[model samples]
Target: MRFYPATLSRLLAVAALAFSPLSWAEQAISDGVYEIHYNAFNSSFITPEVAQQNGLMRSKYRALVNVSVLKLQDDGSKQAVTAIVSGQAANLIGQAQQLEFKKIDEGKALYYIGGFRFTEDEQLKISLSVQPDPNKPAYNIEFDQRFYVD
Candidate 1:
Protein backbone atom coordinates (compact mmCIF):
# COMPACT_ATOMS: atom_id res chain seq x y z
CA MET A 1 0.00 0.00 0.00
CA ARG A 2 1.27 3.44 -1.00
CA PHE A 3 1.02 5.94 1.85
CA TYR A 4 0.86 9.57 0.92
CA PRO A 5 3.10 11.84 2.94
CA ALA A 6 0.38 14.43 3.04
CA THR A 7 -2.07 11.94 4.48
CA LEU A 8 0.40 10.79 7.06
CA SER A 9 1.17 14.39 7.96
CA ARG A 10 -2.49 15.13 8.41
CA LEU A 11 -2.99 12.07 10.56
CA LEU A 12 -0.02 12.94 12.71
CA ALA A 13 -1.24 16.50 13.15
CA VAL A 14 -4.58 15.24 14.34
CA ALA A 15 -2.92 12.76 16.66
CA ALA A 16 -0.63 15.41 18.11
CA LEU A 17 -3.61 17.53 18.96
CA ALA A 18 -5.46 14.58 20.41
CA PHE A 19 -2.48 13.65 22.54
CA SER A 20 -1.26 17.13 23.43
CA PRO A 21 -0.71 17.72 27.15
CA LEU A 22 -2.46 21.06 26.99
CA SER A 23 -5.66 19.28 26.11
CA TRP A 24 -5.65 17.20 29.29
CA ALA A 25 -5.33 18.62 32.78
CA GLU A 26 -3.27 15.77 34.25
CA GLN A 27 -1.98 14.05 31.16
CA ALA A 28 1.25 16.04 31.26
CA ILE A 29 3.83 16.00 34.04
CA SER A 30 6.95 18.03 34.58
CA ASP A 31 10.29 17.57 36.30
CA GLY A 32 11.32 21.24 36.53
CA VAL A 33 12.90 21.19 33.07
CA TYR A 34 10.97 18.73 30.97
CA GLU A 35 7.32 17.97 30.34
CA ILE A 36 6.12 14.49 29.46
CA HIS A 37 2.78 13.57 27.97
CA TYR A 38 1.58 10.03 27.59
CA ASN A 39 -1.62 8.40 26.44
CA ALA A 40 -2.95 5.14 25.00
CA PHE A 41 -5.59 4.38 22.43
CA ASN A 42 -7.08 1.31 20.87
CA SER A 43 -5.34 0.15 17.70
CA SER A 44 -8.66 0.08 15.92
CA PHE A 45 -8.44 3.83 15.80
CA ILE A 46 -5.79 3.41 13.16
CA THR A 47 -7.31 1.83 10.13
CA PRO A 48 -5.69 -1.20 8.58
CA GLU A 49 -4.49 0.86 5.64
CA VAL A 50 -2.83 3.42 7.84
CA ALA A 51 -1.30 0.71 10.00
CA GLN A 52 0.09 -1.11 7.01
CA GLN A 53 1.44 2.11 5.56
CA ASN A 54 3.05 3.08 8.81
CA GLY A 55 4.37 -0.39 9.56
CA LEU A 56 2.07 -0.77 12.55
CA MET A 57 0.20 -3.87 13.55
CA ARG A 58 -3.52 -3.23 13.53
CA SER A 59 -5.72 -5.39 15.71
CA LYS A 60 -8.79 -4.80 17.83
CA TYR A 61 -7.01 -6.42 20.74
CA ARG A 62 -4.02 -4.07 20.61
CA ALA A 63 -3.46 -0.67 22.14
CA LEU A 64 -0.89 1.92 21.27
CA VAL A 65 0.74 4.29 23.71
CA ASN A 66 2.21 7.59 22.56
CA VAL A 67 4.72 9.55 24.61
CA SER A 68 6.10 12.99 24.00
CA VAL A 69 8.79 14.82 25.92
CA LEU A 70 9.67 18.48 25.65
CA LYS A 71 12.29 20.68 27.20
CA LEU A 72 11.26 23.99 28.76
CA GLN A 73 13.53 26.56 27.18
CA ASP A 74 14.73 29.64 28.95
CA ASP A 75 12.58 31.78 26.71
CA GLY A 76 9.49 29.72 27.63
CA SER A 77 9.29 27.95 24.29
CA LYS A 78 9.18 24.17 24.32
CA GLN A 79 11.54 22.06 22.24
CA ALA A 80 11.27 18.38 21.48
CA VAL A 81 13.82 16.24 23.28
CA THR A 82 15.22 12.87 22.32
CA ALA A 83 14.74 10.16 24.92
CA ILE A 84 15.24 6.47 25.54
CA VAL A 85 11.79 5.28 26.49
CA SER A 86 10.55 1.90 27.69
CA GLY A 87 7.74 0.64 29.82
CA GLN A 88 5.78 -2.30 31.16
CA ALA A 89 2.06 -2.95 31.55
CA ALA A 90 0.46 -5.22 34.08
CA ASN A 91 -3.06 -6.20 35.00
CA LEU A 92 -4.74 -7.28 38.22
CA ILE A 93 -4.12 -10.92 37.45
CA GLY A 94 -0.38 -10.30 37.65
CA GLN A 95 -0.09 -10.69 33.91
CA ALA A 96 2.70 -8.41 32.74
CA GLN A 97 3.75 -7.21 29.33
CA GLN A 98 6.84 -5.27 28.30
CA LEU A 99 6.40 -2.45 25.87
CA GLU A 100 8.73 -2.07 22.89
CA PHE A 101 8.90 1.59 22.04
CA LYS A 102 9.90 2.98 18.68
CA LYS A 103 11.38 6.45 18.36
CA ILE A 104 9.96 8.74 15.72
CA ASP A 105 11.64 11.90 14.51
CA GLU A 106 9.90 14.37 12.26
CA GLY A 107 11.82 17.61 11.96
CA LYS A 108 11.20 19.44 15.26
CA ALA A 109 8.80 16.78 16.47
CA LEU A 110 10.07 13.76 18.39
CA TYR A 111 8.19 11.11 20.30
CA TYR A 112 7.99 7.42 21.25
CA ILE A 113 5.25 4.92 20.55
CA GLY A 114 4.62 1.35 21.62
CA GLY A 115 1.90 -1.24 21.15
CA PHE A 116 0.59 -4.00 23.38
CA ARG A 117 -2.16 -6.56 23.11
CA PHE A 118 -4.92 -6.91 25.68
CA THR A 119 -8.38 -8.24 26.10
CA GLU A 120 -11.34 -5.94 25.73
CA ASP A 121 -12.15 -3.78 28.76
CA GLU A 122 -8.84 -4.72 30.32
CA GLN A 123 -7.20 -2.26 32.67
CA LEU A 124 -3.44 -1.92 32.86
CA LYS A 125 -0.90 -0.23 35.03
CA ILE A 126 1.81 1.25 32.87
CA SER A 127 5.23 2.16 34.15
CA LEU A 128 7.53 4.09 31.88
CA SER A 129 11.15 5.13 32.35
CA VAL A 130 12.55 7.83 30.17
CA GLN A 131 16.12 9.12 29.84
CA PRO A 132 15.86 12.45 28.15
CA ASP A 133 19.55 12.66 27.32
CA PRO A 134 22.69 10.63 27.75
CA ASN A 135 23.75 12.77 30.69
CA LYS A 136 20.33 13.37 32.20
CA PRO A 137 18.80 11.14 34.81
CA ALA A 138 15.92 8.89 33.87
CA TYR A 139 12.40 9.83 34.88
CA ASN A 140 9.98 7.18 36.07
CA ILE A 141 6.28 7.48 35.34
CA GLU A 142 3.25 5.42 36.26
CA PHE A 143 -0.33 5.61 35.07
CA ASP A 144 -3.43 3.51 34.76
CA GLN A 145 -5.09 2.98 31.39
CA ARG A 146 -8.05 1.00 30.19
CA PHE A 147 -8.68 -0.28 26.69
CA TYR A 148 -11.96 -1.14 25.04
CA VAL A 149 -12.47 -2.76 21.68
CA ASP A 150 -15.21 -1.27 19.61
Candidate 2:
Protein backbone atom coordinates (compact mmCIF):
# COMPACT_ATOMS: atom_id res chain seq x y z
CA MET A 1 0.00 0.00 0.00
CA ARG A 2 1.50 3.33 -1.04
CA PHE A 3 0.43 6.50 0.85
CA TYR A 4 0.65 9.93 -0.80
CA PRO A 5 2.60 12.74 0.92
CA ALA A 6 -0.64 14.59 1.71
CA THR A 7 -2.18 11.43 3.17
CA LEU A 8 0.86 10.79 5.38
CA SER A 9 0.82 14.43 6.59
CA ARG A 10 -2.87 14.17 7.47
CA LEU A 11 -2.26 10.97 9.42
CA LEU A 12 0.61 12.59 11.32
CA ALA A 13 -1.49 15.61 12.12
CA VAL A 14 -4.27 13.46 13.48
CA ALA A 15 -1.83 11.48 15.62
CA ALA A 16 -0.27 14.66 16.94
CA LEU A 17 -3.64 16.08 17.86
CA ALA A 18 -4.61 12.87 19.58
CA PHE A 19 -1.47 13.02 21.74
CA SER A 20 -1.38 16.79 22.32
CA PRO A 21 -1.81 18.15 25.83
CA LEU A 22 -4.31 20.65 24.54
CA SER A 23 -6.60 17.81 23.64
CA TRP A 24 -7.05 16.99 27.31
CA ALA A 25 -8.66 19.03 30.07
CA GLU A 26 -6.22 20.98 32.24
CA GLN A 27 -6.29 20.91 36.05
CA ALA A 28 -4.22 22.87 38.54
CA ILE A 29 -4.41 23.15 42.29
CA SER A 30 -2.73 25.39 44.81
CA ASP A 31 -1.74 23.39 47.87
CA GLY A 32 -3.88 24.25 50.93
CA VAL A 33 -5.74 26.71 48.76
CA TYR A 34 -7.93 25.57 45.88
CA GLU A 35 -8.18 23.58 42.65
CA ILE A 36 -9.18 24.80 39.21
CA HIS A 37 -10.00 22.85 36.05
CA TYR A 38 -11.13 24.20 32.73
CA ASN A 39 -11.14 23.73 28.95
CA ALA A 40 -11.10 26.39 26.29
CA PHE A 41 -14.24 26.91 24.26
CA ASN A 42 -15.48 29.03 21.45
CA SER A 43 -15.36 32.76 22.18
CA SER A 44 -18.21 34.26 20.24
CA PHE A 45 -20.24 36.27 22.69
CA ILE A 46 -19.49 39.62 21.11
CA THR A 47 -21.71 40.68 18.30
CA PRO A 48 -21.71 43.81 16.16
CA GLU A 49 -25.21 44.64 17.37
CA VAL A 50 -24.19 44.27 21.01
CA ALA A 51 -21.18 46.47 20.43
CA GLN A 52 -23.39 49.13 18.86
CA GLN A 53 -26.10 48.87 21.52
CA ASN A 54 -23.89 48.43 24.57
CA GLY A 55 -21.21 50.82 23.29
CA LEU A 56 -18.57 48.11 23.36
CA MET A 57 -16.03 48.97 20.71
CA ARG A 58 -13.67 46.12 21.48
CA SER A 59 -13.62 42.36 21.55
CA LYS A 60 -15.55 40.58 24.29
CA TYR A 61 -14.01 38.24 26.86
CA ARG A 62 -15.40 35.45 29.03
CA ALA A 63 -14.07 32.85 31.45
CA LEU A 64 -15.25 30.02 33.69
CA VAL A 65 -14.17 29.55 37.31
CA ASN A 66 -14.16 26.08 38.80
CA VAL A 67 -12.66 26.18 42.27
CA SER A 68 -13.11 24.05 45.34
CA VAL A 69 -11.55 22.83 48.56
CA LEU A 70 -10.84 19.20 49.21
CA LYS A 71 -11.00 18.37 52.92
CA LEU A 72 -11.07 19.89 56.42
CA GLN A 73 -7.98 18.94 58.39
CA ASP A 74 -7.88 21.14 61.48
CA ASP A 75 -9.28 24.19 63.24
CA GLY A 76 -8.86 27.51 61.44
CA SER A 77 -7.90 25.43 58.45
CA LYS A 78 -9.92 26.27 55.38
CA GLN A 79 -11.54 23.22 53.79
CA ALA A 80 -14.51 21.99 51.76
CA VAL A 81 -14.35 25.12 49.67
CA THR A 82 -16.10 25.24 46.31
CA ALA A 83 -16.78 27.92 43.75
CA ILE A 84 -20.37 29.07 43.34
CA VAL A 85 -21.68 28.22 39.89
CA SER A 86 -24.00 31.09 39.08
CA GLY A 87 -25.58 32.22 35.86
CA GLN A 88 -24.34 35.74 36.32
CA ALA A 89 -22.27 37.04 33.41
CA ALA A 90 -20.20 40.18 33.19
CA ASN A 91 -17.54 41.82 31.11
CA LEU A 92 -13.99 40.90 32.05
CA ILE A 93 -13.31 44.61 32.57
CA GLY A 94 -14.47 46.85 35.44
CA GLN A 95 -14.73 46.32 39.19
CA ALA A 96 -17.09 43.73 40.58
CA GLN A 97 -17.19 41.08 43.31
CA GLN A 98 -20.14 38.71 43.30
CA LEU A 99 -20.01 35.58 45.42
CA GLU A 100 -22.51 33.57 47.41
CA PHE A 101 -22.56 30.36 49.46
CA LYS A 102 -25.25 28.05 50.76
CA LYS A 103 -25.33 24.91 52.87
CA ILE A 104 -25.51 21.67 50.97
CA ASP A 105 -28.68 19.62 51.32
CA GLU A 106 -26.81 16.33 51.29
CA GLY A 107 -23.76 14.86 53.09
CA LYS A 108 -22.62 15.40 56.70
CA ALA A 109 -21.32 18.93 56.17
CA LEU A 110 -21.43 20.09 52.62
CA TYR A 111 -22.08 23.44 50.97
CA TYR A 112 -22.83 24.91 47.60
CA ILE A 113 -20.67 27.77 46.32
CA GLY A 114 -21.34 30.26 43.60
CA GLY A 115 -20.32 33.69 42.33
CA PHE A 116 -20.99 36.22 39.61
CA ARG A 117 -19.08 38.98 37.91
CA PHE A 118 -15.74 38.68 39.66
CA THR A 119 -13.39 41.25 38.13
CA GLU A 120 -10.08 41.71 39.89
CA ASP A 121 -6.40 40.99 39.63
CA GLU A 122 -5.95 40.01 43.26
CA GLN A 123 -5.99 36.54 44.73
CA LEU A 124 -9.32 35.63 46.29
CA LYS A 125 -9.01 34.74 49.96
CA ILE A 126 -11.02 31.82 51.33
CA SER A 127 -11.12 31.37 55.09
CA LEU A 128 -12.77 28.40 56.80
CA SER A 129 -13.02 27.73 60.51
CA VAL A 130 -15.15 26.25 63.22
CA GLN A 131 -16.42 28.95 65.55
CA PRO A 132 -17.45 27.08 68.68
CA ASP A 133 -16.47 23.59 67.67
CA PRO A 134 -13.04 23.33 66.17
CA ASN A 135 -14.03 19.96 64.77
CA LYS A 136 -16.73 21.48 62.56
CA PRO A 137 -14.92 23.99 60.40
CA ALA A 138 -16.65 26.13 57.83
CA TYR A 139 -15.32 27.47 54.55
CA ASN A 140 -14.69 30.94 53.19
CA ILE A 141 -13.14 31.25 49.74
CA GLU A 142 -11.94 34.21 47.76
CA PHE A 143 -11.32 34.34 44.02
CA ASP A 144 -8.92 36.67 42.25
CA GLN A 145 -10.34 37.32 38.84
CA ARG A 146 -7.71 37.63 36.12
CA PHE A 147 -8.05 38.40 32.45
CA TYR A 148 -5.97 37.80 29.35
CA VAL A 149 -6.58 40.02 26.37
CA ASP A 150 -5.71 39.08 22.80
Report, for every candidate in turn, its global Cα lDDT versus the true structure: 0.76, 0.32
lDDT of 2 by residue, 54-135 (tens): 2323332332222233444556454443443332233434334443433332233233333332223322232222122334
Name the runs in model 1 displaced over 4 angstroms.
1-24
Off by over 4 Å in 2: 1-24, 28-67, 72-90, 108-111, 117-150
Which tens-of-lDDT digit does each residue in 1-150 have in candidate 1?
666555544564465456433335456789779999777776677668877766777788887777889999999999988899999889978798999997766657776878898897788888899888779678888888776775
* 10 residues in a row with least lDDT, candidate 1: 16-25
In model 2, the clashing pairs are 69-81, 84-113, 84-114, 124-142, 124-143, 124-144, 125-142, 126-140, 126-141, 127-140
TM-score of 1: 0.83
TM-score of each: 0.83, 0.27
Best by lDDT: 1
RMSD in order of candidates? 3.3, 14.6
